[model samples]
Target: MIKIFTTIFLLIIGSTGFAIADTDYQLHAELIAKNTYVFIGKKEDFSMVNGGNILNTAFIVTNEGVVLIDSGPSYQYALQAKAAINEITDKPVIKIFITHSHPDHFLGNQVFPDASIYALPTTIRELKTNAESFLDNVYRLADYWMAGTEVSINSILPLNSTSELIGEHSLRYLFLKGHTAADLAILDETTGVLFTGDLVFHNRAATTPHANIEAWLLSLDKLEQIRFNLLVPGHGEVTGNISPIKQTREYLTWLDVTIKRSVMDGLSMNEVINLPVPEQFQNLAVLKSEFMRSVIHRYPIYEKTLFEQIE
Candidate 1:
């Protein structure tokens, strides 16, 4: 613990003794487990302050090369992430996995274009269909940080039907639509580490522009059945325990119930936004902002469903 803290302290305080090349760099990697490292992004919302580096990316060093979980939010951020990985090992990144169709998760493909990029076929379809509008919106939200970032994933090979073996490691890919149309969770059978894309977000309010709440909830149950030694989320800290899964489940359940009740009560969007969150979720970063966005995206569906049921 002390060693990890010391390294972070030096990087943060810009200690001249440390080997960090740029003192102003935004992301940092934490050694989470044997042969595994995670670059946890900011828990805050998209902003110039964070440069939209608010999505977690990780890499595992293997005998053949490195396997990157997700590129960061943009081209520049991915470059920074790769540089950080390079500081430790010169092994080239052999593979890239897009956990979902969200812009933040896949736009960084431009930075790591050398590797074979893979995503669920459904994810590829969504990106192909919505990439234009999504990129436009992401450019506005992330602004300067995404200045040069364009959708570079021309063809994301379908990651289906089997595990890809690299060296002695077997990467078991699971298709989950909990967080988006397609959320990919990779389990490193060698290390028992599960890279759970955005299917699980800890210590932060989850964004749900493309989420099916019911499907996402069932996905959490699937997570409970999986065996993993360490869990790395698309945002927040890595954990050795399943507490993060519990956190995600509770938050989603509360959000679903609250939104459904608000719809039944005929609450306006603003009223739903103002509704108090459970105390357990009050401290999460960007809680209100994300919750408001989620309401805007999902509440109308509930309203329509209730209207049809009444009819």
Candidate 2:
């Protein structure tokens, strides 16, 4: 009796640990329409781990198969994503669309080995050139939060055209080069869903590390011309109206104006970093303390001006 009780106790403890591990990487699937669904990942805060807060992954699926927009950071995430899709449909994932070369968006490419991977030429170049350092950084800062997984890099499909048809839907790929050289925006004409990647952040603050502030503003203008009822961002919740896109544009505009004024006044990057957001923007949900730091890090106006001076 003692032996049996001990064995049962061990099994219960093991099961409990497994359950906790599963919850650590929470995955949620929401049906957006009749045949389409979005998979959102809930993982530990990546920015705070190395860079701010927790992160998630979003993808669109259909009956024919899945056309993934972005892959999450870990192989485990990919596996979980695969499982989530399988739960809804048994068809194979036919194509994978990578919005950019960011690890949070493309590291899970290994999971869809048979699918044709699509990306911008510049995106492919950055992944090839900096993948090593990117992985190193993830391991260095977010290893504990990564769920012990690795992904292999392979070939990627290039897109120089404006649009491509995936399944029964037509996805228009627009080149908006600000956040990254090859940031692609997908517009589904049928569903009126625009997968804007990082081009437009609804409530969240937009990062501009590899961004061109002037070019970004122009891209925003172009996006305004296009019609999209649903805007799916790289981070944050989905938006139904054009207000988020407009808000993102306004934020960038404000940043540009503020930075330019500071530059004219000869204010230092450190000074700009210490500066706070205006009282007007403080009411916005995504413009919290966490995003303020990201904005400062990404598009440090003083840093750019200093670099220009050095050059």
Candidate 3:
């Protein structure tokens, strides 16, 4: 009877892949620099297998306490992240900074109720206005992995650059945009680690759900001017070089030109999705899917702008 029950359980899990996504998030922290660790996420889109763990979340172990960069995807992810942090140090997380208003970056805010959560005024406003819908969308994609997760933001980060001396680290915040209406990039003056939110995607294709290509290019230019020893992007691995910024710029430039050309050529959205991808961007993770998404999200705006110009 026990053997039969075990077989039945295996069958259930095999038949439905989501049955295996039990509560364990399996988070591990990777130390990148002196007292700085990053929880690198999978380079894939949201699915039942990855459970929305497709973005980076990092924490800085300072003299005072832990300073968290982004909260991650869900309540379970935050719990597991906190547990992983505990394995390294017992200090409480004093501050949680949400880089942008993306669901993958800030949904884990609920688990850190004691910590003060901060984001740009635009981020806070975006969360307040669209968080529920974003939650609904993730819940659909990740299923049970999003259990008990809710939208939470406590404080608003200033819309301009600011500085804070926390413990042994001197932090400088850069307010920039292009990936979204507002993106926050943090430069740790003490360690030279720059955390550029989703403003830069290393080997992964950038999502244009809220992208402003023109503004995004300008933000990248600003980032290239900053001298940083290490860069922790919102997605992909941490790097010490400026290649990621260049890669992101190249892709966004291509995307802008492609979409504008498609509109001028009177190509349908489906046609644009089927357009040939350049060899350089072919190696990017989720290239085709992200390109399709970008077309669906941004093509209509280009179409409308071209129409207005013709009028």
User: Highest TM-score: which candidate?
Assistant: 3
Per-residue alpha-carbon lDDT of model 1 for 1-311, expressed as tens digits? 44335435646555566443232336777888777899888898876567677888888998999988887677778888888999989999988888988877887788876798988898889989997787778666755566567788785788876587888788888878878878889899999999999999989988888888789988888888899999998888888888888998899889889999999998898999998888899988889889999899889999999999999
Per-residue lDDT of model 3, residues 1-311, tens digit only: 44335435655785688445365767889989999999999899988788889999999999999999999998889999999999999999998888998899998888887887788888888888888899889877876677677777645444444989889999998989989898999999999999999999999999989988999999999999999999999899899999999999999999999999999998999999999999999999999899999999889999999989999
Best-to-worst order by TM-score is 3, 1, 2
TM-score per prediction, in order, is 0.89, 0.82, 0.92
Error of 1 at 151 (Å): 0.8
Candidate achieving the largest lDDT:
3
Candidate no. 2 TM-score: 0.82
Candidate 3 Cα misplacement greater than 4 A, ranges: 1-20, 154-161
lDDT (10s digit) by residue, model 2, range 1-311: 44335435545666788422232345667776545566543323354232212344555666567777777776666777888888877888888778887778877778888988888988988888887677667655554344434545567878788876767787788887787787888888868888877777756666666777678778778888888777776666677777767877888778777776766677766676577887756655545553456546644556577579879
lDDT of each: 0.83, 0.69, 0.89
Q: For residue 119, what is the lDDT in candidate 1?
A: 84
Better of 2 and 3 by TM-score: 3
The TM-score of predicted model 1 comes to 0.89
